[model samples]
Target: MNRRHFLKTGILGAGTILLGNTLSWAGEIKRDVPIFGPDTKTVGGKKHTPFIKAPKKVKAGEWFDVEVEVGHYHPHPNTKKHFIESISLWIDKLEVASAKFKPVQGAPKARFTIRINKPGKATLRAFGYCNIHGLWVSFPTEIEVV
Candidate 1:
């Protein structure tokens, strides 16, 4: 075979291998659903934890505001390459509200106004999705209603 042909084939083979590996890596990252808590060992885990600001106790039939944020303790990337895509609020298994974000426009934060007519106990949970990272859920926050 000619030298030029040999070099072209070698380069093409190497590029194909690299592209395959990169695609597999991206697929692996896309499959994970992470749950973050206060005991974050890695900086990423700590930064991904959903920080919820809401009253521990509330009155029945009264409306209240709950704020949710990502990277509360540590800041996450907000650039076009890596950024928080969405933040969602849920009561138990039922989702309450969600906020979407763009690359350079919005932060990973949202405020939800909710009301419970009956006196009972409720659980609040928050979810955040990153452009590079997969889904992340916060530790459950219990609220008392009287």
Candidate 2:
């Protein structure tokens, strides 16, 4: 091969190798994105008490009540209401329903009647959020309904 052709081929081969390495490295590594910051405060980080509880075990084919009550302590001074922004209820890997409520006496109540059709262990998870002290905070509580 001529000297000029050899140089051209060498340059092209090096470029291809560089590009391949870069693409492979990018595909092999994953970077995690933070949803909440390090100092992110939840609705009931400390002062805000999550007044919700549920059973971890229950009998199958039985109807049970799963609920969560929240109170916004030290609410924003200018805000009119300190309420849960949203409530997500899930049972047995399925989204059964959703609920919403504003605290009437510093305790907002969200209640749901869960009926178990099959005889097995089920999981009930609830996610809640509210504005406390002018900052948006999330409250997550879960209970088991058998």
Candidate 3:
């Protein structure tokens, strides 16, 4: 009837319902809130690691680039059945931005240019979801602003 109700029901069912062009529910089974895997996995001879590329140090008021890529070491399929759905960027526990992709027409990568005006230690993290493999998160990337 409602979205929450639908999601709740869908999560309990053995089928996945597409939530848009970007998200889906995989059966009625629930795992941890955010699912992540090891740094490297040998799937089909390719390494599927959620890699975050950013500067180790930055100026307080300067703009810098941050790139979030899935299967950086290995290549993930970009087909109708298996592909990355979305990639999100987070600073500490605060979500800063997100990007979504369409299967067969999109790659599992996103680039962000951001400016932080405070000098301190900042924890950067990334989250991505695959159509068939569910969710995956990156190991934290810590940056220093001076």
Candidate 4:
């Protein structure tokens, strides 16, 4: 084969390999975040789903504590092989706070102090990621800001 032809073929082959790997990785990462379904009392749901704790009402422009815990009914494992890796708090589709934990060293919980500038109803959601179980989301909690 000519040197130019060989070089072109090699470059195309490398590019194809890289593209294939990237696509596969993206596909793996696109798994839907799990949430409690019709059977909300399942053990998996209790172990993996995040639970949000906040007051029912708060004054506008005043900071309040929001706590997120990975498990409410049953505690999730925190071993070296499996654990909750991170937790994120979202308010009406906007991420407000996040926390990371090390296996066997940190618990899968976080407290975020935040305030809403305007008086209205605010929706809060929490997401927890586990190393073995992918991602889990909590039910939306609504708080009235006065």
Candidate 5:
């Protein structure tokens, strides 16, 4: 079998496969993919967030897009007072841009435009925030740019 087969059978689910394929989850921080190292979680322990994702292996100077959405994972759902404070997108270590969303009945949507400015490798992360619960969280989305 090849990589696809290995990934399909070797892991239990999406998150598990992600953790096993990428950076080790045994540390304080972890990324679901390899090329990128451990990701930063909390900004100051007052905000919640997650990382965005895009084509990791793309041609230099090519254009791409990354979309991220965040919502309450709790079975009861969060109260209306809770909402996403901001969403940030980055290429490598540069802070490309950020966005804010108002409280809604459903999940929050954030979009990011990306172009392989240089080449080689890249990483994307999304951060979410909820004021009511006062919690912060992060999830990493990975890709490749040829």
Candidate 6:
């Protein structure tokens, strides 16, 4: 075969392999996205879902404490095999804070002091990730900023 033809074939093969790997990685990300149920009545939901604690009303521009705890009702496992990995807090579709925990040492909980500058309704949500159970999201908690 000619040198030019061989080089062209090699480049095309490398591109195809990279493209296939990219597609496979994207599929894995889609499957790893956070999931949640409508409520926490089930055992799996209670163990994996994150619960948010905040005030019902707050003044604009004032910082307040927001607590996010994974498995508020039912405690999740803290062993090396199955444990909570991280916790994140989101306000109105924007991620404000996050915390990471080591297995068997740190708990999946965080406190974020945040404030909104605008006066309107704000929605707060928490996301929790487990080593075994993947990701889980909490129900939205709405607060009014006067």
Q: Which one is best on lDDT?
A: 6
Q: What is each predicted model's overall lDDT from 0 to 1?
A: 0.72, 0.43, 0.70, 0.74, 0.48, 0.75
- The candidate scoring highest on TM-score is 6
**TM-score of decoy 5:** 0.53
What tens digits encode model 6's per-residue C-alpha lDDT throughout 86-107? 9888787677899999989898
Q: Which residue pairs in model 1 clash with each other?
A: none
Cα lDDT of model 3 by residue, 82-103, tens digit: 7888988877767788999999
Question: Candidate 2: global Cα-lDDT?
Answer: 0.43
Each model's Cα RMSD: 11.0, 17.7, 8.3, 11.9, 13.2, 12.1
Ordering by lDDT: 6, 4, 1, 3, 5, 2
The C-alpha stretches of model 4 lying farther than 4 A from their native spots are 1-39
lDDT of 4 by residue, 57-129 (tens): 9999999999999867688899998899999888776788999999998999899999888899998878787
Reference-based TM-score of each model: 0.73, 0.46, 0.71, 0.74, 0.53, 0.76
Task: Supply the global lDDT for candidate 5.
Answer: 0.48
Which regions of candidate 1 fall more than 4 Å away from where they truly are?
1-39
State which candidate, 2 or 4, has the greater TM-score.
4
lDDT by residue for model 1 (10-66), tens? 543453343332322223233333333432455866677688899999999899999
Worst 10 residues of 1 by lDDT: 19-28
Which of candidates 1 and 2 is the stronger one according to lDDT? 1
Model 4 score (lDDT)? 0.74
Candidate 5 structure quality by residue, lDDT tens digits, 1-146 = 88644643443244333433243332333333222112232232212335344555677777777876554232213356646655556565555767776556545657777676665566666545444332233455555656
Candidate 4's displacement at residue 130, Å, is 0.5
Residue 52 lDDT, candidate 5, scale 0-100: 44
- What would the per-residue lDDT of candidate 2 be over residues 1-146, giving only the tens digit for each residue? 88545643554345334323232222322322111101124332333333335666666767677775434343322234545554545564566756655454334457777777776666554444444321111233343444
